[model samples]
Target: MLAIGMDLGGTAVKAVVIDHYGNVLKTMSKPLGQHATSIDEWNWKGVVKSVAADLMEEFKGRITAMGMSAPGICNEENTAIYSMPGRFYGLEKFIWTEYLDHETWILNDAHSALMAEAQFGAAKGYKHAILLTLGTGVGGGIIIDGKLLQGRNMMAGHLGHITVDADNPELDIFKIPGSIEDHIGNATIEKRTYNRYEATHELEAAYRAGDPVATYVWLSSVRKLSIAMCSLINALSPEVFVLGGGIAQAGDSLMKPLAAFMEIHEWRPRGEGVPVVVAHHGEHAGAIGAAAFAIRQSTK
Candidate 1:
């Protein structure tokens, strides 16, 4: 049988149809309708339903299960997002099963990305791993002892919001001081570089051009990320670390400096440093992961 995985992003909804083996058979994406001036004006609920209907019609009897991934903390029931302020209008606590007329599983987007990696991507075959998605903001997840760590409040793997510099005045979305996101996330690139760079790519380009300011800013961010990874390594002790999202696309520009810094900061007991790699599923990670989650849950 096949499974449906849907990723509800800020601008679009991405869905994938995959077989039991996790091979993708079809993919769909649609914009999230007109922009809403306020939460009450949002139209994403309809958009999501429409997308699901279209996919369901196409796959028909072949589809067996479905899962959704979105930007928020999933409730313990895995039925809906319990907390996601300032976006997606009616998403919070909206029951997917009742609306979609099917048994649907849901998870946080970051957790879904890590799930994709653990099931079929970078962290496949590893019992313990961590994933960090560095984009406009940093998102994270962890797998421990072969299971995703949802914690008591399902907020276990918010690695980016963890404080790396407690004395710094800046706080992240979670109001944590000097969070790793504040240091390296794309949202703070301009502020961190004194308005000289608008995005991480621009900074990386300037750094490649031997610009002193760009070099300083980029390396500093990478260093903070390394420190964060080191802290996670010590705490969770995952066998591997996977990096994904837009920022990880910097290739050697990001990985090289991160490697150099990790060499200095990461703790290596018995000379066994944790392996760090880029995600294998790329942009489709959330969709693939949602499908994987659905397939497994349905079988169980």
Candidate 2:
């Protein structure tokens, strides 16, 4: 069966058509523009309408279902937003499902990423796993016994918002001080390194060149990430930890320090031999996961 997947991000909305086995057939993307202030800002209904029209026009009679992944807290019914940080606002009551006029499943963007990893990527065959996306903000999802953990109200997997420091909290526009996002996310890394350099690529190159300032900034971010990972490992003992997103592209630079820090801090049994791997699908993971969800929902 063919399904449509939509990944709504801060700056872009990506859509894809995929088959039941996770193979992408076609893809499309559109810039969300600056109007996408918060999770509610994008004429969400309009976007969905446009995407549906596009897919229907392209595939004619092939597509069977649709699924969406957004960067926010999605309600248990998979219809509306509970809370969103970067893009879209005042959307607590807005329901995207109603606008679609088709069977649709909405999930937190991180949950979709984790689902992608669990179903087809690094976490495949693992019953319990944590997928972390180190991007503009740190996003995470937890999977247990092959099921996504959507707590009461479907707000269970906001690992990025977990408090790291009770006393000296790192503040961000979201106002959630001490949030894990504030510690190791892309913005944090950028701000920490900007005084020494202006561009992200430059900072990365500096890190590669062994610049002390860049190393300090990068290592500091990785250390915070390691702490968060260790906490998750202790709590869930996931079989695999899959890391993805723009920052994850740092590859060994990001994973090595994180692994070393986890080694020193994590508890014995949970930490031992735990595999930390990079995401295989890259940015398309959300789309793939959404497609997978759509296919599963159709079968059900």
Candidate 3:
């Protein structure tokens, strides 16, 4: 029936009410208020309560279950956040379920995105799939045999941390170079284009004009992304790879080169040509996935 979904982002929080079919009946968003540099348990609980209260007030009894997509490693039960490397300061100690009704389900935001794709978007019919979202950072989700793979410690599908380059490493929390995120994230695109403050339109225009710098930058990003995809293809052999998030709007400009690279690098001869498709749901995938999770939890 109906469910409530919340996507807790670094800068903003998005909440939505959806039916079992993944239709958004109503939605709301708000800027994340002042958060401690280290997000303590109290602060984390407070934030969830405040946001949930706002949505619950409107939907009221219509909500059957609730799901939250946050940016860290969620506990196996999906009741608490175990770790969030750089962004969520004091989250390690927070038990999210304590802040909500016991019926709520919590999951990694990336996982939620993948669930959305698997349930209603690009990976709808695929038995195995991977969802990669390129935005402020690279986030990913993995599904095998039509089920989400929550590896040991519930951190299996963190595709962004996978190292693409060992020799020229991109140093991050894990000290790995050329992390998937480092190579293809929006921040990297902004840096490469030399338009840190320019909008996506300007960068797209530059690419259209055949600017050498922009071309090189764009291709470089695509190459890095393709390498990561090829690795995933070799490892998981998913039937489809769904790319979403802001940069994915580049369409063929990004997909064409990625396709070529995947063809060249993928190890599996039979599945070398796995389709790389854009997510139909776009930014709404997270919300939809959250809703789906909520529905599933309620049914249980």
Candidate 4:
């Protein structure tokens, strides 16, 4: 049987068809048709309806399930989104089942990325894993004993918003102070650098060119990020860490120092520092993972 997976991103919606073996067969995409900061619920519903109809018509009886990866805290029962509205603000308590006619699942986008990587990418073959996607915001997920850690309210792994610096004044919506995302998200990085670079890579390039200002700024953020990782390593001790998203695309420019700091700093009660690797799937990870989640849940 096939499964339909959708990654409902702020800028666009990516959909994919995957077979039982975790292979993505066909893919579809469209603009999310909403503002970056907010969404019109009625317009979003219409967009989803049209997209679901297209997938259903093409797959028909062969499709066994449909799943969506969305931003926010998904309810434990998978019936609706309850909080943390990054883009789909009006979707709180919005029932997702009404959008389709199949076995369905709704997942936090970061969790979906973890599912995809655990099954087919960086975290494959590991029982305990951690994934951090660093982009406009920092996203995270935890895998324990081969299962995604979805807690009572399904907000258990919202790692990015974790407060590491209580005195940090960068407010995330006017209240949160010193959260990880506010300190190191790509958006924050650009702002912190005074818009000197448009993307993280530019900043990395400047740092590599031995630019003193770039070196200081980049290292400072990396140090904060390493501190956060050390906490997770000490607490969870995952077997591996997969770093995805635009910022991670900087590759060793990002990993080398982080690894160096982590090796010296991360708790080693179990042994040495865990392997931190780049993600195998990129933008399509959410859709692929959404399919994998449904496929796994169906069998269980």
Supply the global lDDT for candidate 4.
0.83
Where does candidate 2 stray beyond 4 Å? 36-44, 89-91, 169-177, 198-200
Q: Rank the candidates by lDDT, best first.
A: 1, 4, 2, 3
List candidate 4 segments past 4 Å from native: 34-42, 84-86, 170-176
Residue-wise C-alpha lDDT for candidate 1, range 63-138, written one tens digit per residue: 8899999988889988899988888777889899899998899989999999899988899999999999999999
Superposing every Cα of model 3 onto the true structure, what RMSD results? 2.8
Ordered list by TM-score, greatest first: 1, 4, 2, 3
Q: lDDT tens string, model 3, 195-235?
A: 64254545655766788877777677778888888888888
Q: Candidate 3 versus the native: TM-score?
A: 0.88
Candidate 1, pairs of clashing residues: none
For each candidate, the alpha-carbon lDDT, in order, equals 0.90, 0.79, 0.77, 0.83
lDDT (10s digit) by residue, model 4, range 179-256: 778777877776778878777778889999999888988987888888888888788989898888888888778888
Who wins the lDDT comparison? 1
What's the CA RMSD for each of the models? 1.2, 2.7, 2.8, 2.3
lDDT (Cα, tens digit) per residue for candidate 2, span 83-127: 774447655656766777777887788888888888888998999
Q: Give me the candidate number with maximum TM-score.
A: 1
Higher-lDDT candidate of 1 and 4: 1
* TM-score of candidate 4 versus the correct structure, residues matched by position: 0.92
**Residue pairs in clash, model 3:** 38-90, 39-89, 39-90, 169-177, 170-177, 170-178
The TM-scores, one per candidate, come to: 0.97, 0.89, 0.88, 0.92
